[model samples]
Target: MAHLHCLPPSVEPRVSEHMPQIIDMIKQIIDSGCAYSIDGDVYFSVDKFSKYGRLSGRKLEDNRAGERVAVDSRKKNPADFALWKSAKEGEPFWGSPWGPGRPGWHIECSAMSATYLGYSFDIHGGGMDLIFPHHENEIAQSCTACENSNVSYWIHNGFVTIDSEKMSKSLGNFFTIRQVVDLYHPLALRLFLIGTHYRSPINYSDVQLEKASDRVFYVYQTLHDCEVLLSLHNNVNRKDSIPPDVKSCINKFNDEVLVSMLDDLHTPVALSALSEPLKIINDLLHTRKGKKQELRIESLAALEKTIKNLLFILGLMPTSYSEVLQQLREKALKRAKLTEDQVLQKIEERTTARMNKEYEKSDAVRKDLAAVGIALMDSPGGTSWRPAVPLAMQEQQVVAV
Candidate 1:
């Protein structure tokens, strides 16, 4: 997680540590009469809150359809949930106004959040499955605890699923972060997660992850190329003017990335915006027409700046492009189950084949290398190689464990 720069929260308070505040919150909910006590157990009454189902859009009736008949019929509604549970024979107990009991699961969030972040806050998030009984009960309890208590926004991210079913251990389909990062880069996983919109379900497959890994390598590769070229010609050419098309591509890419991100965090569209500018940069660096242009260096500089800035906003930029490239290549080599020496040896064989006028043999070697993600670039100087996105044989070639 640190490799991807996802930081920990500033506050990490536990519900047990905040028992006084939790008890105080239960007292408020009870005072509001939004809750009821029975035999020292407290449960929030859904009947008291008319806006109980507002966030989940599950009507009170809709929640009761498939539920098992309530064992404890003392509850007012089937959807009503525990605020505090009376201590059983052998459980840890906290002193509260409702006797020796501990906080229930739902009210712990409400209590802790209200105490720390206050009753009303900006954003709350949870899985879609939590919408019905968990979050609905929270709203019933929290809003009634204090006047004008509310959450401004509730963001629900889609579940990561496999074969159209939610990824689960009992289902025999679950991939952990440690298992995934062994086969692919961490940023690749992060990129794949954001490739789809936040609200849409994204399927998890070896194939999809491979594509994302390739995309990450490509972006890092392009950045490395631009950096090298920009440094190679540090002095900008004043005699030539920047091409209008370069400027336009930069503009469109910038606008699309920002606009798409701002519009409900539509990240997939922002990701698409990367293709045009990347193509232009690569074209300028390698293509014949682009090399002959008067302002090639100027164009590269502009595009690189635009790309680097946008990548920062997307959290896609690595601390060092060269390091990222090297790391990804190492991972690719592992995926292919081939060492660096083996790859170089193949390149040598290909070079010898081409030198001896064995075109078929050379082509065959190139194809084999490509199958393992080694891309050979033929230049006037020599046949150089770079790592491209590896083909999806890693599932078999490399065990994720």
Candidate 2:
């Protein structure tokens, strides 16, 4: 699954591995008089932390009236949170000076992060729901235990909704990443996942996935065509400068895409910025029409390299160009309900009909193939077939009509 998603270093830190450090931090907070113990359990005193609600923007008083928080009279403040939970029968235990108990959920993260990433980190991210008590408590615990320990950015991403409803197992609307990729290419799922701003809620639907799949096909299809053109023009001796418009397109991609990504990880805008460069390349590839001079081979190579680098950064098109195009063609064939052998047979029959001067039969065959979404192109080299509708685009048009 990690390979499929192209994730990097997906390692989980076990709280049990840092039990002593957690116990020490808890002791440090208690000795600082910011926390207290009753019987065997330890709870942090929220009243001691003057900036307690700074992260969540909710005062302790606000939480005091909130129904979601569980109030315990044993704590000094109603907003006080547990740091160490005393062991119960049949429960996991780690020996501490206070008693045999385990670290609380928030404390576990604090201790593990401090032990691994030290007192501070650049970005701390989680779901929007965690902005409240969970993250708020982590900040409170970390600040009290370690000096200058703080997150530079508290990045919280929005949830995925199914047709405007929150997806849940009990609701029976939940879909796993594996299930999603099973139906669509992993890149399509990746594109759908990042199609919106990270902080904005994303709605999941088959239509959206199909559209993303189609976009992926179009992107790779363009890349494949660019590769073919560049292969013919990959000579360094041509030594022609990049055309003005093409250079402008590349500059815009570099400026817009990179700047958007750097500005708070605005990937949606960055992905949208890709369209300008792609359109420019497509126009150039189709013909040198508008320009007085054609673009040199080096210029095409540069454009191809620029786009490939951008796609690499987005974790798309990891395979060789030919391999990706082959996969896309196979997918397109399945969508058109046609196999390679069937397509080949039709092409052969059309060739035979053309050779016999059976123009009507050949034309009829072409029309039939077109109806099934197959496009046949005859060339000096031979005959080749590609799906007439680029999958998603065709489906979208049909729906529109």
Q: Which run of 10 residues does model 2 get worst, by summed lDDT?
A: 392-401
In model 2, what are the clashing residue pairs, if there are any? Answer: none
Cα lDDT of model 2 by residue, 322-394, tens digit: 6755665676576567888998998999999999999999998887777655678887899998645543345
Write candidate 1's Cα lDDT for 271-348 as tens digits.
888888889889888888878976888888888888788677767778899998888888878877888888889888
Listed per model in order, the count of residue pairs whose N, CA or C atoms clash below 3 Å is 0, 0
CA lDDT, candidate 2, residue 251: 88
lDDT of each: 0.82, 0.77
Pairs clashing within candidate 1: none
Residue 280 displacement (Å), model 1: 1.3
Off by over 4 Å in 1: 65-70, 235-241, 390-401
